[model samples]
Target chain A: MKVLVPIKRAVDYNVRVRVKNDGSGVELNGVKMSVNPFDEIANEEALRLKEKGVVTEVVVATIGVAKAEDQLRSELARGADRAIHVVADQDIQPLQAARILKKLVEDEGIDLVLMGKQAIDDDANQTGQMLATLLGWPQATFASKVEIEGQTARVDREIDAGIETLEVDLPAVITADLRLNEPRFIKLPDIMKAKRKPLDKRELGDFDIDVPTLEVTETRPPSGREPGRMVKDVDELIATLKDKGLV
Target chain B: MSKILIVAETLSGELHPTTAKAVACAQAIGGDIHVAVFGSGDQGPAQAAAEIEGVTEVLYVQHDENNAARAATLAPQVVALAAEGYSHLLAANTTTGKDLMPRVAALLGVPQVTDIMAVHGPRDFDRPIYAGNAITRVQAPGDFVLVGTVRTASFGAAGGGNSAAVSDKAVDAELPSHTRLVEQKTGGGDRPDLQTASRVVSGGRALGSSENFDIIFKLADALGAGAGASRAAVDAGYVPNDMQVGQTGKIIAPDLYIACGISGAIQHLAGIKDAGTIVAINNDENAPIFEIADLGLVGDLFEVVPQLTEKLG
Candidate 1:
């Protein structure tokens, strides 16, 4: 089966994001960008499924600006068969992104779509589920383990309560959680080979895009927490808790 | 006034406490709050939802398809009920909400705001992005129905006193058969849930072994707080994945949080930043956790944890 993995070019997970002084959005000019961590895990899972012979091919797709091609190339280097870059100069919300993916799934005749549960930038956590609904397909979000047997996929999800196991038929959507797998590092030979791989370019207008209903009015730093005084020892700590009625 | 519909979260036909906290957020929004309880077997959760003081009405939806509480089934029902002139649809930002609400929004052709932490107005709210490192104020257009999830940790549970009316309701929506729940394996038994616990004690990789984790659990039991773990500890198999507290894990805002042997990563800090009082106990005085910890102690966790547990006892 052909698997489609949707990746995002997001601010590096380790960077300390700063809001623009104008209250427009977070400052992204010249900031370090990389494949979203969870999406990287998704890419890794798709690659593993191919290695296990469960998936016949792996294709990675992204909806972002021209600069997002860099992320697409990076995933290609990680062993995806090809990449699809839908260039969008404007901000694409989760709903629009899902709508675009639905078109791609139909156009590509894809079976399984693996993606991150949420992008660290928007933190919306909506695309996978939205796409599943629009297609009337099954979904497994925050998946830690995915197993394929014939036309069915058994997924283990990490949830607030604990691990939940679900079984869904093929042509399902699975969003990767952090523990899905440790993604492999790109090898020099693979990077060179990726240079020759197929990279298809498409326009955001090529598919139907929904107008966004949510608008951002302001962006700001979280209220800072001041470091309080430290106690001398266990006695002092216990005394402080008692004094504050925390204990 | 905006009419609000809260999707009550349930497990085993019982109301989850997070539903009350979502009610608190609705109360803040100043709306005619109605909670929709979807269950197949029991009406207990619907009666419980009615007791949340600010709730105006409880609508109980019963169907055999609602047995597993799958999002694919619940989303269509929620969308159908939301057609009754509800202006806003809300759910707690738990796994169920995160899984279910976006589908509702997509079906309704509206964009959803996840993890609403503050309510500035009916259309305006504050939500965290980049894992709570930055906060953004979002506004939904008044022309369309709004769908969002309340960050239960950011608000206290609505007090229970008044009894609102509960009524049985039926929704006509086509449910799918593609997704099926195999089973759910829960851990951290007999402990207060980490997300809503008033106090929490979390351990890190420094705990070394699962056996050593007992000391942390003992301290939690002594203080009657929930026990959590850093991703490092969970990855090392010192604890189960459910005990994990970090960006990818549970985002908690407890009254007091004690970090034992955890050198705070940005992701770990993100989860606990909303906590009321943070206490760090690490042998390394300069661990990053100390920077934000309201109270810091420099000591080995093995000795300090046992001593602290004894002291609390």
Candidate 2:
């Protein structure tokens, strides 16, 4: 089966996201950018499925600007067959981005769509499910384990309470949770091989999707938290919680 | 006529906190409310949702395959059914709600406010941005409607003992999943979910040792609180990644959150901003965790946590 993996490029998670001193928006001038952490899991899952030969062809796709090719090449180096680029900026809302992908999925003839549960930037875990709905396919989100049994798949789903067992047919969208797998780093040999891999770039408008007309009217730094004061000792802390009836 | 449609979720026939919270948010609109429920068998999940006050009727989606909601499948059906009546839609801001509700939003061609803590005006609502760091009261574009995923921790569980009549509705949702799951390595540790717990005991980098985190765990266990860690604490190898609570981590809003040896960074505060009552424990008097903390304890966590645990026990 052909697997379509969607990845995102966001601010490097390790960096402390700070608002610009001018109060415009996030300070992104010199900030590091990496593939969304969860997307790495999606990439890793695709590679693992390739190892089992269950997923015949694996391709990583992203809906972002031309610079996202940097992120896409890394996925190819990590071990994807090729890459599909839906050129746009990363700031578009989740549904708008999903709409661009909905138009692109038609030509791909994909059997399954795999991606992270949510992009770290927006923290909106909607795109995969939204894409599935647009395509009238099934979705197994927050999947911990995925196995194919003939035409059906048995899935172990991670819920807030714990995990539950589930099943569904082919042509589904699955979002990778944090515990899915640790993504492998690309070696020098693979990096050289990735340069040779076919990287296809498609304009968002070519698929009959309008570039969403939206803008960040105003963006500012998040509110500040006051510094905590050192008390005399532990006794005073309990005394305070007790007084507030919180303890 | 416009109304609010709800899908009250349940597990193992037990009422989930999110169900009541969703119902409560729906009732705040002071209009007709319709709830749809699905489960293995019986009206246990349905009955639990119907018990929430002001529930007009509970629609039981009695398809055998409707045991768990396949949102991709149900989104179209809900749009068709709900379009016949309601203008607005509502669900709890939960893992399931986050996963499934937006599918319906996408189908309806509306932006979903996935985690609204409160609602005001006719369709406008209030939601937190940057992980509850800033609350924005937004007026939706039009009758396009607002899908409010209520924050479960922020709203108290509805309890009016009001159970309405149960009616069955057939839903032949043809949703089937292609990706198959093999296994799950659940966090089988003895700890409550950070969202559901009333009290949370968090550790920071000052803990020094992951093994030394036993004190935080012990304190949490004694108080029936959830155990959490600052990003610094998790980075310093003092706790598991699941225990990390911050903007980039998990958004947690407990009734009482105790920060031990933690100097709260802005991102960390973003995660716990909605906590009803915050208590910061640290040696530094000017720790950032204290700004939002209702109660601040300046002391050595090593000396303080044991005493608090004993008091809790």
Scored by CA lDDT, what does every candidate get? 0.92, 0.74
Worst 10 residues of 1 chain A by lDDT: A204-213
Chain A TM-score of prediction number 2: 0.92
lDDT of 2 by residue, B262-301 (tens): 8988779878877777888888887777777777777778
Candidate 1 lDDT for residue A184: 97
True contacts kept of 2: 0.32
Q: What are the per-residue Cα lDDT tens digits for candidate 1 across B1-313?
A: 8999999998656799999999999989998999999988699999999999899999999999888888988999999999999989999999999999999998987899999999998889999999998899999876688899998879899999879999999899999888999999888478999988999999999999999999999999999999999999999998999999988799999999999999999999999998989999999988999999999999989999999999888
Estimate TM-scores for all models.
Answer: 0.99, 0.82
lDDT of 1: 0.92
Output DockQ, candidate 2.
0.27
In model 1 chain B, the worst 10-residue window by lDDT is B10-19
- Least accurate 10 contiguous residues by lDDT in model 2 chain B: B176-185
RMSD of each: 1.0, 4.3
Number of the predicted model whose TM-score against the real structure is largest: 1
Q: Give the DockQ (2 decimals) of all models.
A: 0.84, 0.27
Q: Say what the RMSD of model 1 is.
A: 1.0
